[model samples]
Target: MQRTTISVSGMACDGCEQNVETAVETLDGVNRVEADHTADTVEVVRADDVADDDLHAAIERAGYDVSA
Candidate 1:
């Protein structure tokens, strides 16, 4: 599995964190997702085939912004 850490904006509470986690977990080959509102980041454990664009899109779909 490959681990990726991406910063997410607009995560102001636990609910937002859960939203980010749920969104990322929906992707194929995503093994795990841990989102931290406090840290404003999402850590994804997924297969190598997972694309960065997919991750960014998932975060956006969750109503959050991905920081570059």
Candidate 2:
């Protein structure tokens, strides 16, 4: 598994955190996701071949901003 730290913006509360976590964790290559509302960061464990664009789009669609 490959680990990556992504900066995510616009998480207002725990619910938003859950939503972001769910979105990231749902990806095919994602093995785990820990999204912190206060930190505005998401740590992910992913299988090889998953691109950063996939991660960015997933978070954006879930109503957040991702820092590339």
Q: Which candidate number has the best TM-score? A: 1
lDDT of 1 by residue, 1-68 (tens): 89999999999999999888999999999999999999988999999999999999999998999999
Tens digits of per-residue lDDT, candidate 2, 2-60, equal: 99999998998999999999988778989999999899899999998898889889999
Assess the local accuracy of residue 61 in candidate 2 as a C-alpha lDDT between 0 and 100. Answer: 92
Give the range where candidate 1 is weakest over 10 consecutive residues by summed lDDT: 16-25
Q: What is the C-alpha lDDT of each candidate?
A: 0.93, 0.90
Candidate 2 displacement at residue 22 in angstroms? 0.9
- TM-score, per-candidate, Cα-based: 0.97, 0.93
TM-score of 1: 0.97
| Residue runs of model 1 more than 4 Å from their true location after superposition | none
